[model samples]
Target: MILKTKKPVVLLFALLLSLVLVGCNKTAYINSNNISEPSELKEALTQQNTVIIDARSAEEYAKGHLKGSINLTAGELTINEPVKAMLAPQEQINKVLSSKGISNDSNIFIYDNSGGVYSSRVWWTLKLYGHENVKVINNGVNAILDNDFELSLDIPSIKETNYEAKEVNSSYIATIDDVKKAIDDEDTTIIDVRSRAEFDEGAIPTAILYPHTKNLYSDGAFKSTRDTYLNYNDLGLKKDQSIILYCKSSFRATQTALLLEEAGYTNVKIYDGAWLEWSTKDMPKADKKPSTPATSQDAS
Candidate 1:
């Protein structure tokens, strides 16, 4: 999502009306093969090495969750040391996954109560650490329940493993310096995926205001690849150009970044420090200050 050059404009805009009628289905996602239908989990839960992770609060996990799914909240995978809700270190990630009984070969499926905002962050975290076997459950817990899949109140016991995270996948991340360079880079686009109200309050200069909510359909499921590509391409983002995304932290950014890649955008990166770090620095900004300080709800 780029300025190097442009390609033939996608002609799928007219198909939106027909797509809206089919609702959410596995066939809808052609760009990324990382989505799982709720019904697919019925058999997935029975397979060895299959681990379903519920990326919600402990309280939410206690009330109900997909059967055999383990609970791993955002707090478990992130830190607030350098910035608000930055992703945890590789060592911490290894410990957390091992303690949760997630092995290197585990076929992991992650979900939240109903949306990708939280769960997708976890999915990106796994990918950053080289856990490519993971998939995010579309529509999450609500859809799984609606599909008549079983939920359990019983907390499963864990058999911890000796987990090791791979070398940091730098492609998914962008440092503050990288962002500074991109600010004036002719070929790069930095998107601020925060709310319109937040964007009005303050934002990095030149950052486009494309909220994370736009990534979902009215039903909270992700839009199809064609829809996502078409709608996002309206920003004149090229599939081959560079795109940088950020939100309050990078939770919301990861949500869009992953989808952008899924929609055939090859060069998407998340500014993990996001507005939190940028606001802290003496960098050039569009306004005086940000409106709201981040809350735990906004952090990933």
Candidate 2:
């Protein structure tokens, strides 16, 4: 009877060992196409292929950040030569990302404190550089900090790796001439993703006001995919037509582009220089009420 009991116990231990091995092999990652929540980020931290990006200034990141996260600010991906905050060189971006220990297969999670402004810029930069395994943390830094998860002051030791830049996808971006051409095209739709107050002051001729915040909820999280689709659908937008987005600058445009693209809108493009360049060039501009009060025209 003792011998029989020993045989069963040994078999049970072997079975449990196999189960543990299988669990260890399992990978945990958030869906790249979806906006990631704090709970999902918590699970992603347990996975080996994940990398959290603190999309804030170095000084801000030094104060506190999600554990195991690396700092990558929007300023790093932009240059101020010909225009302020335009995209940096692809090779430079590749080198910076490689030095940060980001591999091609790494699942990047980006977050920032200023709403989704900074985080969305990084997200667009990565996507433009051909990184598809990326997601902006929903509701930005507030969502993460509110969860009461531990913040780390320690900077992680990164193991640098080679990261090659892929072929450029220019279709994702639009130029002033592109906007001019779209102005004449009936099949194209120009969207101004700024506040109604700003739109009332002055806007691109024929551009419709569809503020980027319309894509989010009161809590600051992105709405459901179905709801996002319906929201844009109410604007009479068909996925087949060319959709152009712009704001005072291009950050908000990038945010709206991401939301619409995820909602299945194809042929989407962003006028990178946006109203700043448009207004500077003496292009056709209009206001809802021409006699409205003057407001700040700074491009921030």
Candidate 3:
């Protein structure tokens, strides 16, 4: 009985299987592509190769956050005092990344307690520094809780890591001058993604309102699309329109832009400068009050 041992083949197969398993355990880099779901996130974090960032206030984070999440409040990035101190310069960001044991290649997911406010800001900031593996938690805290993931109160020990900033990508952001040019260009439609009050008070000279919030349900998530096309049609927005969106800051505008893109809009841009920059700049704004109707006696 000559039984040739297939031991070498079996060993090669075992090695390949091990390599596949190891690759699967590595952190998944997210971008516009590979946007992970809550379940996927749970699995990814379990592998211990990801950095979950809570883009909410430290207090809010303390109340509840995804397990093993690090805090870098979005408010801090926007010049708020305490949080800002934690993120004043690139050195601060590097320090935070190091403390969290995050490296330049870490898969980062940023979420906020509020809807999309701070999370989107963090998304924009990470992109500003040319970090491509970062993503915003689509529904923020709601997504995590709804997904039945556990939370923790333990603070993670900081581990220093090196982070390098690259030149900002001009395409991901719209400057005041870019907005001015877009307004003057007839082909572009500036959409005010703020509330009705914000629009009524005074908005970009000829911007139209297309509020970001909608009442719809998708597994407890806010419906990204309006219930009816008539809502957007009433605002003179056509399917082919090139739209620019702005809010108090770029936060809401980016959310609206994302929703618009998801809703089948072809050309969309976010004016991050938004009202914060618009109101301060020497630019035309719609007057807050409507002109009074002429008296009957005064009418010719």
TM agreement with the true structure for every prediction: 0.86, 0.81, 0.71
- Each model's lDDT comes to 0.81, 0.79, 0.63
- How far residue 139's Cα lies from its native spot in candidate 1, in Å, is 1.1
Ranking by lDDT: 1, 2, 3
Q: Give one digit per residue, the lDDT tens place, for model 3 in 3-119.
A: 555777788999899666534432222334323457657766866568888888878878777778899866555543321112235665565556667777878887775556666
Which regions of candidate 3 are displaced past 4 Å? 1-35, 79-100, 215-220, 224-241, 261-267, 288-300
RMSD of each: 9.2, 16.0, 18.3
Tell me the tens digit of each residue's lDDT in model 1 across 1-300: 354333323335435644655454333543246877765666678889899999989999999887788999877889998898998999999999999999999998889964687888998999999989888887787677778877789999999998899987999899999999998998998889899888887798778777888777767777667777776777778999899999989888888876787788999999999899999998888855333332221111
> How many backbone clashes can be found in candidate 3?
5
Q: Model 2: per-residue lDDT, tens digit, 164-250? A: 877657888999999998888999989998888988878887788877776665556665555666677777788777999999878
How much is 33 displaced in model 3, in angstroms? 2.9
Which candidate number would show the highest TM-score if scored against the true structure?
1
Candidate 1: where is the Cα deviation over 4 Å? 1-27, 30-32, 287-300
